[model samples]
Each structure stands twice: as structure tokens, then as C-alpha cells.
Target: MVSQPHIVFLTETWLSNKIPSSLIIGALPYTILRFDRSSRGGGVAIIIRDYLSYSTVTLPSSEHEITCIDLFHQSAYIRLCVVYRPPTYSLSKSESLITCLSDIHASSPHPIVIIGDFNSDSLCTHPTPIDRLFLDFQISVDLTHCHMFPTRGNRCIDWIIANDPSLIPTISIVPPFPSCDHSGLSFSLSSPQSPSLPSQIRDFTRVDYSAFFNYLLSVDWFSLFCDCPDIDSIYSAFSSAIHSAIDLFVPYRTPRPPSLSYPPHIRRLIKHRDALFSKVHLPSVRILFDQCSKKLLFEIDKWTRYSTRKKLSRVNDLYRHISSLTKPKLSIPELVSPQNLPVFDSISKSNLLASEFASHFTLDDGCLPSLSSSRVPPSLSLFTFFPHEVYKSLRKLSPTCSTGHDAIPQIIFSKCAYALITKEFQSALNCVFDWTQCNQLSLSASKCSHIRIGSKQASPWYSINSTVLPLENNVRDLGAQVRSDLKNSSSIKMRAQKATSKMFLLLKALPFNCPSILILTKPMFFHYLASPFWNPHYSSDIATLEKVQHTFTRQLFYRCFPSPDYPLSLPSYSDRIKTFGLRALTERSVIDRTSSFGINIELTTSTPRYHSFPVRISRWYSQLPDSIRTAPNIRMFKRRLENHPIIAHLAKLT
Candidate 1:
């Protein structure tokens, strides 16, 4: 007897980066899950190996259902449930368990396996209605205990219960310790088989042939042969027929136990049967070829009269159709015939008995059970499990462009700024130079004009519009005076100049690490943020706004992109964009929360005050390296105004 593999489960662990990485062993391939319920903390997770793939499910607020996927194949499905029963103190503990199981059984196909800490032991020691209901529910669902741990000790609270006894579990309890309240439970599956195959066989030589033949003679064949008088004579005279029929109908014989080893002839026969079963029985390749060949011959004849193109097409089509019939038809034959007979022969000794066993048995490793003794359901609720608001904001900040190309905002900003610096935009140069304190020689319109003659030179403005009394030099002098007036006049204005750190502000407020930003960023990130003005579609005002936004944000991200060792976290709303199937901008933006952090800059109202400012962290941040300095100031400012309950949230974000 060979031992079957195991399916395990466990959960409710609040995993953090602080814990050492350890592999869950004893069974192969362990699954680990971590979910925090809310900011306050209450989440459910499960780990299962094999059995089936896992998915998330959502339950109503009042219900505590073990949400999982239900895949149905024919009459049965492989169902595993990972349950997290809150400590006995919660009011709805039993209701949660019952409702969860009810939903699972109702929605999923069975045979079902529920593994986890139920926090209850036995019916005799049952502590709550939910535990009692679970027991009754198991009974109602026809579930049985193939095995349980601590069978002889105090009542078994932790369990691996399933709908089918054939799917019973073998459990090992991990010793309890002072650190954790509950003991770790491990479970394995038990092989479902009878001690041996039915040992019945039949023999033909000892049967009474004459009596059997006489019985067949009483059937209504006389009517069909009424017109042929020779039929009665043939039946009455056929002695060979009786013997032939008797040889085919042998009595069943009880098989004796099989020998430990096979004779050479028996092994050869077994191999022969296996080959025949593969080629002729299961796929029945020989039979398919025979049938397909006949069909093809008919099709060729039928399509031969069509035009040349038509004939060719029809021939190809028929060939493809005939080919398709081969695989499926062959599969049925292969499945019906027994391929491995020797294994059965070793168990039953008799060749005939082995043959019978081979016809009935099939081999499958019960769809790989879970690694831990815990039962893990297939699906979980994506919306409920992940942070929704933060994810939404990230989606807004990073979006697909009209052409569905990734236009990184930072890249766009850099390009625009480089262009402004290189291009001969006099106004732009004037703005930048004045702001930067680079006061140098200034060129007026008059200084830009010059003309030459045979013996003398004169200003171009005077040469073009001339009068003797109003000399060319005097006209140039007047033009120079006008240009200087424009340059120095207090009335001449500049585009409303506002110093903003909005882009940097957004970067500082990112809820998750930079990696999350990378994940949510799309080509549209560049299109809207970096080149909004370059798009002929928008007015100059809009374009200028876009330029400022792009410049600041691009620089911010370029400076703060996380180091390789420390990856950034994804914003919560990104889950909606990727996993929830919400793809459109309108859908993403309406509920987006990360918008404020997208560009990190804000416009301030023009106000003047004569008041002392508080001595705070902002002053401290101004002293650090230029790289991390701005981020700290923005963070400190935000903290001063609104103290977020989550302290050092950025640490978690990374």
C-alpha cells in the first residue's frame, strides 16, 4: 500500500518585512498570503499547494464566507476552503463560519475540503452554535473524518474535514509555543483503495454445452426461418455449434493469490497488451485510419467535378475534417482498454484476475492537495482586499495616451525645458536671465540697425525713412530711447509669474513607493503632463500650465526614482485599473485619489502678512542634501497642517 499526498492550509498572519523568511515545509509547494483588513488591521489569508489555483472572493459585510472560485468538470469539482475563524470573542464568529461554508457549498462543486483553525474542537466540546452547526453541516453534506490529530488527547479544535471519506486527511500537529496562541496543523491525504481487487474468474471447459444450446433453441427464431424448411434441419443436425458456443461461455472461477514475481511469458503478454491498448484500443488509431481513408475516398470523388480552385479547396477542407476526427475518436478507445496489466497481475497472481482489475482501476494523484493541513479556497475579493482610494489616484496620474503610447511626463518636461533653453526666444531669455541675476549688456532696436555708403555709414532706420532736418543718427537715437523705455518701464508686464512646487509636492505625497508609480504610469503620463501646451488642441494658457507642471514633475521623479535595493509600492487605485477591468479615463478619474500627489504642486492665494512663523521641521529639512531636502519640507508642511494618523506611512510605502 502506497501513501497518498497531503493538502494543507493556515492563515491570519500579519506578515511584515521585519520577519525572517522561512519556507513552510513537510509537504511540497507552500502558498503564502498576506492581507491587512483595514488600516486598523483584520485580514484573512490562506496557503494551499496543488488541489487547484487560488482566486479572491468578496462576501457581504455581514457574512464571513470563504470566497473561492468554483470550477466544474463533469459531475464533480475540486473544492478547497481556507477558513479564518476570528477568536471566540467576536459576536458573529459562528455566523461568519456558517455563512461562509453555506456560500462555498452553494456556489462551489464538491467533494469539498475545509481546512483551517476553526477555533473549536469537537461536538462534545463544541463552544458555539457555529461550531455545532459546522458539525451538523458536515453531517448534512455527507462529510466524514478519515483522520484527525490529537485523537486521544483533549478535543481536536483544529481540523481538516472534507465532503468525501475517500478524501480523508492524515494530520500532524505542530507543537504549541509561548509566542503563538494556536498550534500549527498539518494534514495529508489517505489513499482510497480496497485491500485487493475482486478475484473472480470463469472457466469454459466444464460447462454443459448441450443444455445451453437446447435453451437457445427455444427462442423466436422459428418465425424468421419459417419459409426455409432447411433451417430446422440445420439446427437439429448442428453438433459442432453446441461445442463452439460452450467453449465461449465458461463458468466464473475464484482467483488464487498472485506470485511475487511474474514468469517471462506473462510479462511479455502484459507488454503486448499495453502497446495494443495505446495504439489500437485508446486512440484506436488503426480503426480511425481505416474509417478516414474510406471517407476521404468518397469526398475526393464527390468534389472532383468542381472547378480547379474549388476542387483544391474542397480537398484541403476534407483532409482537415478527416484529420480532426482521428484524435478524439482514438482517445475513447485508449481510455476503455487497460494498458498496464502487470501491476495488477502482481496483486492478483492469476492472469485472468489481473485482466479484470486492469479494466476497472485508474491512476490519479488526487489533483495535488494543499501543502498545509489548512483548506484554501480558490478565489478572494480583489476590491475588498486591496486599498481602493490610493490605487484610483495612481490611475489618474498615469493614463494611456490617445494613440495608446507611453509618454512619460518627466521625459516630456525635460525635452520642453531643453528646447526653451536652446531656442532663440528673446522674451523667454529675458524672463530666465532676469530671474537668475545674470545682468549684462542689453541690445536695443537702434543698436541692431547699420547701413554703409561709398564714403560714409548711416543707421538703417534713417536711410529707409529719411528727412534732411531729421537726420538718420537722430532717428536711431529716438528709436533707442523708445526701446529702453519699454525695457525699464514699470507699466510693462510679464506673464503672471507664480512660483509653485506643485509637481514636487505631488511626488512627496505618493502613498506607495516609487515602484507603484512606475506600475501605474502609462504613455499618457507624458502626453498630458509634459506636452500639454505643445498639443495644438489647448490654448496658450493651458499650454503654459502644462509646461510648468511637466518641468517640475519630471525633475522630481528623475531625482527620487527608488534605488534598485528598495522598490516602491504601488498606489491602491492601480488595482482597479489593472485587476478590476476599469480601463477608461472617465471611469478612472471620477474616483481617483492620487491626483493630488500626481504633480505635487499647489497654487497659493496672494496674501501678505507680518507675523512670525513657527520654528519647525521645514527649517531642519532646508539643511539636508539637495536631493532629499524638498521631499522632507513638503512632508513636514503636510504634517503641520494635517497630522495623518499613519506615522511614517512612506516607510511602509517603500
Candidate 2:
């Protein structure tokens, strides 16, 4: 108690039901959570400080001697478990305890720490059954038994295991407590640092791009390292020039000052109170100072509470209010089939239960009743023509044919669109204003852009609310690129560049192992659209996309297998794919398309066209086997697709 330890875990408490926890805790404000076996000399207890918000967790499946608690702070929690395995522990008891620990570790959002007095010496010459089990558990769950020193005498029975050892940086063995035989294990769990406001950054928004572009052009990029024979020398020289250009053009931004917490009136009152305190020697000043101090304290307290409540009401109160209204009434337990066997797999159980539940109900055929003499709902139709398109149409006209309306010849107007363009543009603006006003909203000028699509290079300036928009040749919408000429070149190029930058960033920042690398990159293969972009239409685009995966696999190979292959030619992409047992990006795209098509085969669209999703994927989707198409869930669909190899062989349509 004098040491003021935040928490204390004890094993072999030797206390029974008659000994209330309060008697042991005494007058200290601490929570004593105990899990006692029916017999004596086998119990676990955790004494946590009263201030921490925490709850005791019980494992129904685990009948062994173990206790767990979740110490929470805001959104994050740390799960601490205490274990006590007797020297006479059975093989069956060890398995159940280890299984319970594994479950807790897996379910926790943050890494957990487990400390115990297992009495199984880790430094024993011959490993016991419990020791073997612990070793296997450590390997399977990626946990570490960090304690190496002896706890009781020369044999180390006490252990401190954690799912992530890096979290607990400092580990030490301290002398045993009074009347205690086992030594104490002291360790600290490091919390991740809270995010801080950035003090400085390159201000790219105000960069002079024109000068930067000129600087880049002036550099002899093609003549990089002409005397050197290696590609590394050329790449290094090229990178240095580009980096210097960026540093010169991009300006650094100054940090903004922190805002004042108190309002103006409260701050003024505080200053007045402080000024009075300085003149406390005078009797009148003392009286005024005391009054002002009280009032200032009241106002400060009110403002602080208001500010805190306002910040929390936006999230915490709303979630709690909503959760109270929608409480779950039913819970499904394990189901047994007619054959008296329990349904263990999630997919099979879900399908069986859904079918059983639906057997008691009926659904409508989804057909509307026919009516006589019914009027169709009216829909407002609008037609639009680009100004450049109108100019092009006028250019194809003959000068001999005079314009019917406005009495103007086509040749004069075709020479320059100034006359026709201004009147038409004003009319379009009026329509836009009317539409936006009717909707009771104004479009953001920053969110809007003007672009001309198709092969024509004719682009006219467009404005919203008297603000001219910057013309863009290409724009990315919903993570898919759209270009002026509808070419895949810019779209694929941007995607490859992003993928390369993201891949290297992940590799450099994260401390993941070899297998974790593939897991991290698994989510990046999917292209946003199910359109032609899914299957790159051009040969160059396909090569560019495939190279991302190839380069990744090559990097992974170099990291895993060490050899004198630095200057040696690496294996081909196909051989590497076989070596790593991974499918190609194009192959993955087909699988994705096939599964999507299978799910939406019966879905009908009003404006179905040749380039529509279902129509485009029909070729690949139609060839899939019935088993894969009929799969009930994503997991089953993936499992079935893996068994079928012909889907990977289909040539992508250009």
C-alpha cells in the first residue's frame, strides 16, 4: 500500500469463501477480484486500484485456476490475466487453460499480458507435458514467455508472457515479498503516444509549378551518369535532381498558434481577480479580491463543464441513447440436425438455420397488379449539347446555306464561336441557377471541375458563381480515373504510381514478418470498378499492373531467401508466382468478376448495354462450374473457386 502500486496479482491465495476480500484489502480503496477453487491452496486474485474503470471477465469453458480483467481507458483496453497451475496439473487441465488464454488474446483489440506462477521450471533439462504445451502455444499464438530468471530458488517457475513483447519494454526480477517464496516479476506496458499536431510541413498548395517544371526540363535527365555502367548510378543521380527541384519550389508552412480555452468574459474576470490579489495588503482590496476569486472560480467551473459536455455529447451520448432503444431480444444457440449431429461450421449452420426458419413462412412473387386506364408518371426530360460540339457542327455546314434562325450565315459563326457561345452560355447559367435554387443548395466551386470528353481538343472556359474553374484533362472519381479522351493510359499510370508508393511505405513503416507482408498486400489487388478497367484493355496497361505484383513478389523473395543473387538475374514472374503459390493479378480479377456475376446473374437493369457490368462479365461468369456459382457465401465461393483451375486460364478480353 505504501509503494502505491496500481495493480497486484496473487496466486495460491489459500483463502476460502469465508474470507471476505474486504478483510484482505483492509481500508485501501482497491478492487479485489478473486476466483477460488472449491478446495483450499488454489485460488487467483487481482487487486486493482479503484480509480481505473475496469470489469472482471469470466471464462465459462475454462474450469481451471485463472482470472482476467479488462482495464479500460476511453476507447482502448488492456486484458490482464492471472494463472496458477499446480505442480500436479493434469494434461487435460493444461490444454483447457491454454485454450482459454488463446481465446482472450485473439479477441482483444490490443495485445494482452499474462503473468502466472506455473511451478513448471522453464530451465528444466527434460521438458514436462505442461512445458511442451506452453512451447507449442507460444509458437501457434505468436506469444513470448519473456521471464528468464529464476523466481523460486534456482528454478524459474514464475512466467510473464505477452502476445507482443515490444509493448512491455522493461522486465525485471525483484526480491520476494515478506513470507512469500516466489520472486516478484515487475514490468511496464508502454502505451502508444497520442497524436500531436504537426509543427511544420512542405506547403505544396502555394508552390510555383511553372518554375519547377522549367527547372526539371533544364536538368540533363537523359544524360544521368553516362560514365557509370550500372542502373543504380543513373537512378541515384536522377532522384537527386528531382529532390532538389522540389525543395526549391515547395515552401514550408508556419505552425498555427494554439487557441485559448476560456471565453473572453471568463478570461477578463480571471485577470481582474489576479490584479486584486496583488493588492491584498489593503483591507478594501482584500475584500474585493476574495469576492472576485469566488465568482471567477464559479464561472471557470461552469465553462469547463460546458466545454467538456459539448465535446462528448457529439458521440458518446448519441451512441448510448441509440443502443438503449435497440436491444437484441433473441440469441441463437448451437443447432443440432435431424441426424443428431451438431452443426459446427459457420456457413453450413447459417444455411441450415435460414432454410429451417424460412420453411415456416411464405414470400410474395413480386408482381404488381394489372390496372385498366392507368396514367404513367411524368418525368422531366432534358437534352444537352457541348458548346465545342455545337461549334464543330457549324464548321461542317456550307456557307451557301444560311442559318434559318437569327438570320446568320454558318461561315461567319463557324470562324469564331464568340457570338453563339455567349448567349448560349448565359442561358445554361440561368438554368443551372434555377435548378440549384429550387433544390435549396449551392454547389461548391472547389468540388466542381470542367472537362471535355472525346477525341476533340476544343475546350471552353466554364465558371460557377463568377468563379472560373481550372480545366483538367483527367480526374479521378470514386477511385476510378476518367480522362478527356477516355484513354486507359493516364488511369493505369496513376494506379501503378500509387501502388508503388503505398507498397514501399508499408514495407518501410511496419515491423511485420515475411508472411505478414503478403497478408498486408492482399487488399490492394482489387481495382475500383467492375468495368473494362478490371481487365486492362491495352497490353501496356496489363504489363504495368502486373509489374506491381511481380516487383512485390521479387522483393518478398529477396527478403526471405538470402543468396548471391544481387547481380544475378531473378526468376521470371511466372516461376515466382509458382514458387510463392500466388495467383496473378489478372487471374484474381477474373475470379472477382466471376463471383460478382454469379451473385447478380438474375439482377435486371433498365438501361442494360454492351458495356454494362453483367454483360461484360458474361463470358467469364458463364464458364464457371455450377458448384462455384451456387455457393451460398463468400467463404464458400472462394473455397469452391480454388478447386476449379480452368477459370484462371481464360484469356482477358482486350
The sequence of per-residue lDDT tens digits that candidate 2 reaches over residues 283-334 is: 8996787677677767776775465345334444533322332222222333
Q: Candidate 1's C-alpha lDDT?
A: 0.39
The parts of candidate 2 lying over 4 Å away from their true place are: 1-426, 430-449, 454-471, 516-521, 524-534, 567-569, 596-613, 625-640, 651-654
What TM-score does each of the candidates earn? 0.28, 0.32
lDDT tens digits, residues 556-633, model 1? 344445344432442233343443233323222111212122132222222111110111122222323334323345
Candidate 1 deviant stretches above 4 angstroms: 1-8, 15-35, 39-42, 48-76, 89-93, 125-131, 145-148, 151-153, 176-178, 190-654
Q: lDDT scores for all predictions?
A: 0.39, 0.66
Best by lDDT: 2
